[model samples]
Target: MRLEQKYTALLGDVQRRAIGGGVPSAIGQLRLCFEALGLASAIDADCATRLGRHGLSEGKFVLLSLLRDVPEGLSPHALAERAGVTRGTITGLLDGLERDGFLARHADQVDRRKLLVRLSPKGEAAASTLVDEHAQWIASLFADFTPAEMQLLSALLEKAWRKTDRGAA
Candidate 1:
């Protein structure tokens, strides 16, 4: 309700400015952007709550998920690339996950100077559970949407994404 009020107030301000021909076009775009932001925030909060139960942040969960099947493990560099994070960020994630006993790191067999990261048994189990639950949660959220509707929505989102993917404020 409060968010809706704010959205209406914003539209009112735009109209009051007498922006003329642009107002009609801007209204739809502005409304869509606001709704998208609200949805993103809601989804993020949901993910945080779910991850908190397992003592995992999104970053830690991503690492575990990546290593779930990688018995041989990956180097810190590889994980960083996979997760699209900096080396320092990857190191921190690995340190926290390792401390929690969710993953392990060891020197590479062929390259002793390099370390490889792998999931511990506990991490493997948690990853499986989390992935399954997350999938179910996402599906449930969209249960009311028909398949056709879902496709349309997805397509629209992709189109909208193209506009904001570069040089967007």
Candidate 2:
């Protein structure tokens, strides 16, 4: 059975017992379902393992991912804000990536106080290879789903994520 099905079955039991026990409300139930999405479980583990083989930690992987999407790269503050991490955390991540020769930090042309980050050639190559491999791995996991289904799932998840993001802000 699928991971979600397992969680759903357990939720069914909870729903049945809601009358006797103070079970969660509708919103709470959705929270449970979201928890079951398990982004930190198999998905992170698999990506961590893969990145580990290249001497990259999960934190570094996340940093690299954010950088890869933008060729010009982000400032340290911007990176931290977008990654939902602290400036100190971004510093550490950048230090490691820089030490490993994956990225470079330089003064911003227009604003010297603000630093700019950019991927080195090595970083670009690594990001390209790793992203393709990760995409394939993710696609295989969701192979059972139709294109339409995947699109709907993506839309719903993005909506939920946006809501959560707004709440955080």
Candidate 3:
């Protein structure tokens, strides 16, 4: 069966199981969903807080992180792809970063039609500081997890992500 059909059947089974268990109401399921969303939002907020000190929002930080790995910088299209954001959004982000002296956009030397983005001196300094802080913050977040538990969690997350990507493809 197609993945969608399999997913739909799985969902139906879950609903049936829930109903058979004398679940109080749909509200319980809604609450669970909300709680999951809350956790995700909180994680994102924490990252944003850490990034904000270096004049970067979560999205901007993601973009800069992508750029940091490529000294020559990436074209806007490639940056958007790596950042998992829209072209327009990347454009606006680049504009904001440039205005704040974090990055600069210039025509590619070999291809004038393509714009290349690079971090300015100020931006590189900010990025280095933010990267260090982010590493510490991430380490703290998982401080409670044992090495085995962390490995297991990472594997599970990667598996789930691969499954999701396959379905999307």
Candidate 4:
């Protein structure tokens, strides 16, 4: 069924089962949450498809994106922190990317004990293309919104995100 039909039917069910029209604005919020999940899933699929064309997974692409501008490269620990992953996870990702010729690791000049990650020429090209494509895809989604609508949407999303932040309470 269409998303609107699914939403309407769910809301109707809620109305039938509850008093006062289903939790006083919560149904609409629930609908928005569901819509957001759908959007996220679509974006994930799009990302996977695009990355698949290059034989890269999300982790590998993230490393590529991070390394694209860092000709000097980043330490494994720093890249892990920036990528919001653990040192072990970064190691695994680096292994695959290195094997795929997307990145290179070298001993740091300042700290010989530490290694830094840098992108290969092929990786740089892929990163540039993927970043551009991703930006265009994002723009297409918001192209229909008016400037005011975009501003309102941004503010609302910020507010909602702040409310759900770790220390919000």
Candidate that would win on lDDT: 1
Error of 2 at 90 (Å): 0.9
Per-residue alpha-carbon lDDT of candidate 4 for residues 89-163, written as tens digits (9 for 90 to 100):
999999998998888899999989989888888888888898778678779988999999999998987777777
Residue 58, candidate 1: C-alpha displacement in angstroms? 0.9
Q: Where does model 3 exceed 4 Å of error?
A: 1-35, 152-169
Count of clashes, each model: 0, 0, 0, 0
* Per-residue error (Å), model 4, residue 149: 1.2
**Could you tell me the TM-score of candidate 4?**
0.80
For candidate 1, write residues 17-134 as lDDT tens digits.
Answer: 6566554546667777777777787889999999999999999988888887789999999999999999999999999999999989999999899999988888989998998888
Q: Give the alpha carbon lDDT tens digit for every residue of 9-125 in model 2.
A: 766677677766787546465544546475546687888788899879877777777889788778989989988989899899999999999999988888889889988988888
Write the number of the candidate with greater lDDT, choosing between 2 and 3.
Answer: 2
Models, CA RMSD each: 3.0, 5.2, 7.9, 3.2
Residue 152, model 2, lDDT: 96
Q: Give me the runs in candidate 1 sitting further than 4 Å from their true place.
A: 1-9, 18-25, 165-169
> What is model 4's C-alpha RMSD?
3.2
Error of 4 at 12 (Å): 7.0
How well does each candidate superpose onto the true structure, as a TM-score? 0.85, 0.63, 0.70, 0.80
Error of 1 at 38 (Å): 0.3
lDDT of 4: 0.82
